[model samples]
Target: MRDTYIIGVGMTKFGRAGDWTLIDVLEYAAARALEDAGLGENVESVFVANMGAGILNRLSGLGSAMVDRLCLFPAAAETVENGPASGGSAVKIGAMAVGSGAVDTALVVGGEVMRAVTGWEATDFVATLTHPEAEYIYGVTLPALAGMFARLYMDKYGVTPEHLAMVAIKNHENAMKNPDAHIQQTVTMEGLLHRPEAVVNNPYVAEPLRMFDCCPVSDGAAAVVLCSREVAERSGKPLVRIAGFGQATDTHAVHEREDPTELAAVRTAAERAFAMAGRKPADVDVAELHDAFTILEIAQSEEAGFFERGTGHIALEKGETRPGGRLPINVSGGLKARGHPVGATGVAQVVEIARHLRGEAGERQIEKPRVGFTCNFGGFGNNVVCFVLEREG
Candidate 1:
């Protein structure tokens, strides 16, 4: 197989994009990526990753519409949906296309405009991904599950609410440096925890998982352009190779897992990605984990081999995951503060790591990162996609 590389990346400001249509957000990000690559009419294919356009916007055929909007006439067009992992899944397919020599270049864009509906409606729409008979019918939502997980983990590992608040505080600080981040505000431990009225300041979404611990429901988009190495080299851009990728699945129902606290899918997926890249977890210079909830970042850190199985929260206490720390994570703010636009999140994670590798991350940039990793968790660890990206000088 031919090697694949990310030639360009772009994303729309993730927030309540008032007055912007779902297609508009997709086009905005896609055009930026295409323009970054100096690509135009000749693009070979376009894969749009989205989860709620049909349910929330009453729209479909996004792929075909995207091709027409961008004037990439006659290019193959399709939409990819794989729950919250939709974006990472789309990138995987695009890389496969380039690697297989079936396409010289592919445009992968992920977006969601969930704000059109009330937050209540959005929550119900996303819950559709849960097992219909086992999980959804009972009215269980993602936060409710995460809360249970957080409580169990805390009981087992001694992770305090302070630790959870630390994740939110740190990621929020990181988001301040990211112009496109959804919540670019600073959060302090005192404000979230120490104060007398912290409850009012940060209400509980699910016990043990407060409002600050949860990622905001956002409307946004992110895009990437993948091409073969030969094509990438011709563009005179620094190459960020898709070194390796891995994906795995677990039980669709959270309760069915043998050990709910163990993110088996994350562990297996990261191991596969690292093995394919011929690297170890210690070789990674930076990472982006799907921190849809504060606990996820800590759980994934352990499962991905960044920290010991039960010591992820301890590492967070030590400042190891900060920008200049041992292995800075979520420097692009992660989904915690960068916003989680479901389908767009996985793609956005890749975009952040790619920027880190390229040294274009500006204020949040880590120093000379040679290898970057990303994990896009889907469906409460039911499905996941992980990628190992390498920077070539």
Candidate 2:
């Protein structure tokens, strides 16, 4: 297989994309990526990643629409959907097209215009990812399930509300430096947990998981331009290779899993990615873990081998997960503050890592990061994708 490199990346501001159709947001991101690559109409394939355009926007045929909008005539076009992992899955498909020598370049774009629906409607749409008869029929939202998981995890590992709040505070602060982040405002521990008005200020979304602990329902888009080694060298951009990628899936029903607290899919996916890259967890300079919920960041960190089980919060307390810390995670503010647009999230994670590798992250940049990693969690951990990226000359 030929080597693949992500030579260009682009993202729209993550939040409510006012007056922009999903197609408009997607086109903007894809155009920026093409311009960033400076390859001008060399794209041979296009993949559009999205989850709710049909359900929420009453639209489909996104791939064809994007191609027509961009005027990339006759390029192979396809749409990919895999719950929230759609972006990652789409990237994998693009890499395959390049690596297998089928295409010299591929444009992969992911986007979601979730604000078109009401908050309750959006929440219900996401909840549809759960098992139909076993979970969804019973009205299980992601936060409700996360709350139960958080309670069990706290009982077993001594993780507290304070620790969860700490995650929020750190990510919120990081997002303040990211112009594209959705929640730029910072949060204080006192405001979230320690004060009398905390109850009103940070009300519970679900038991044990407050509003601050959850990622906002957002609308955004992100894109990446992937090319083979020869095309990459011609583009005159820093070579950020997709060294390795792995994906795994657990039982669709959360209750069917043997251990509720263990994110087995994350562990398996990360392990495969590291092994394929011929590297270990310790080699990762910066990482972007799916922080759709605050607890997910901690739990995924542990499962990804950055910290021991039940000790992720300890790492947080020691300031190890901050931008200049031992192993900075979520410098893009993660889904926590960067905003989780579902379809856009996985591609956005890759975009953040690539930007840092290229020395473009202004304020939250890690000093000369060499290897970056990303874990895009899907379906409440039922499906997960992990990627190991390395800078190459």
Candidate 3:
């Protein structure tokens, strides 16, 4: 495969994009990325990632719409949907197009306008990712599933509510530094767990997973410009390449997995990515884990090989996962604070790491990060995509 590098990255602030249509948000991010790349309307291919446009927005043909909006006439355009992992899948396709000599320049944009519906409606929309017969028909939602997973993990790993609170507090602090993050307010352990009014302030969403633990429903978009080595070198941007990527899937139903607590897809995907990148967890400078729920941060940290199994929360207790620590996970505040615009998230993860590698991340930047990793979890870990990105000089 030919070498591929990201030339530009852009994203809208993750929050309520009150008046913007889904196409509007997607166009905004795409324009910014193209402008950042200085590519004009030279894109040869376009990949738009969206999960709920058909269901939530009553719209379809996103890729064609984006091409028309961007005026990239005749560019190969397609929409990719893989539940919440749609962005990662789109990026993967874009990279493959460039890497396989199919296209020199590819544009990938992912966005979702979920808040247009009521909160409950949005929840039901997202719950459609679960198994239709075994999970969805039984009224299973992502938060409910995460709560059960958290309960099981806590019992097995000795992770207490305090650890979960720690994840929320830390990510909230990180989000404060990210202008694009959805929730700008900071959270405190006492306010979330210990205070008398904690119950009212941060009520339970699903058992063992409180309001603070879950990412807010948000509307946003993120985009990246990928190109071959020659194009990247000529563009005069820092060379941040897609070093390697891996994808894996487990059973559709959570209970069908041999070990429900073990995110086998996450483990396998990360392993394949790291092997392809010729690096290990210790070599990673910064990382992003899908933190739809706070416990997921702890669980993914372990599964991604950042910490030993069942020891991620212990590492969190040691301040190892925070900024300035050994490894800064989710310095962009993760989904917990960054806002999970489903389709936008995976691309947003890449955008964050690329900015860090380019030394462009503002207050939340890591110190000279060389290698970065991202884990985009889909369908309760049944489908997963992992990417290993590196800075080349």
Candidate 4:
């Protein structure tokens, strides 16, 4: 297999695109990535990643639409959807295409226009990812799942509401430094947990989970240009190779698992990625964990082997997960603050890691990061994709 490199990355701000259609968002991000790669309509294939555009936005055939909109007339086009992990799955596909010599250059774009309907509508749309007869039929939303997982995880690990709040505070702080983050406002423990009006300011969404703990419903897009090593070298751009990737899946219903709190898929996927990259969690200079919920950051940290199981919350309290801290988990503000446009999220995580590796993360950048990693989780840990990226030394 050939080595695949992410030569360029681009994204639209993670917020409401009031008037832009989902395809419009894709076109914008795709154009920026293509231009960033210094390619003039040279893409050979296009992979569009999105979860709800078909039903939520009343749009489909996004890949062909993007290729035609960008005037890459003959480029092969395909659309990929794998629940919330859609973005990561698309990148994996594009990378594999380049890796197998099937495609020389590929553009992967992921976007979601969830705000097209009311908030409840969006929630229902995401709930469709659950088991049709077991979970979705009972109206189990994503936050509902996170709430239960948080309760079980906390009870077993001695984690508390304060620990979850710390995750929110840290990510909120990081979000402020990100120009494109959705929730740019800073969150204080007092406002979220201690204040007399805290209940009003941060209402409980699901039991033990407050408004601040969950990622906001957002609409945005992100894209990346992937090519073989030769194409990357020809682009005269900083080389951030897709060193390795792994994907895994668990039971469809969350309760079917032997251990509900253990994100087995996440752990297995990260291990596979690390083994392929010949690195360990400690070797990861920086990382982007899929933090659609605050507890997910803590949980995923452990699952990805960044911290021991049940000790992820301890790492959060000790500042090990904050920027400038030991590991610096979510410098792009994460899905919690960066916004989770489902399909756009996985691709966005990769784009964030690429920026840090390229030394273009501005104030949020890590100090000369050599190795970066991203974990894109889907369906309550039922599906997960992990990637290891290494800078050219």
Candidate with top lDDT is 3
lDDT agreement of model 2 with the native: 0.94
lDDT per residue (tens digit) for residues 1-393 in model 1: 778999989999999979999999999999889888875446899999998899999999999999999888888999999999999899998988988999999999999999999998988898898999998998888888899999999999999999999999999999999999999889889999889899898989888899999888999999999998878988988899999999999999999998978999999999999998888999999999999899999999999999998899989999999988999989988899999898799899999999988889988789999999999998988999999999998
Global fold similarity of model 4 (TM-score)? 0.99
In candidate 2, stretches whose alpha carbon ends up further than 4 angstroms from where it belongs are none
lDDT tens digits by residue: candidate 2, 310-340: 9999999999999989999999888999999
Off by over 4 Å in 3: none
What lDDT does model 3 reach?
A: 0.94
TM-score of 1: 0.98
Indicate the residue-level lDDT of 105 in model 1: 95
lDDT tens digits, residues 1-393, model 4? 889999889999989989998988888888888888987447899999999987898888888899889889899999999999999999999999999999889999999999999999999999999999999988899999999998999999999999999988988899999998988988888889999999999999988899999999999999999998888888889999999999999999998999888899999999999998889999998999998889999999998999888899988889988787889999988999999999999999999999999999988989999999999999998999999999995
Each candidate's TM vs. the true structure?
A: 0.98, 0.99, 0.99, 0.99
RMSD of 2: 0.8
lDDT of 3 by residue, 1-393 (tens): 988999989999999989999999999999999999997457999999999999989999999999999899989999999999999999999999999999999999999999999999999999999999989998899999999999999999999999999998999899999999999888888899999999998899999999998999999999999999999999899999999998999999898888879999999999998998889989999999999999999999999999999999999999999999999999999999999999999999999999999999998889999999999999899889999999999
lDDT of 1: 0.92
Clashes of 2: 0
**Can you list the residue pairs that collide in candidate 1?**
none
- Cα lDDT of all candidates, in order? 0.92, 0.94, 0.94, 0.92
Per-candidate total of colliding backbone pairs? 0, 0, 0, 0
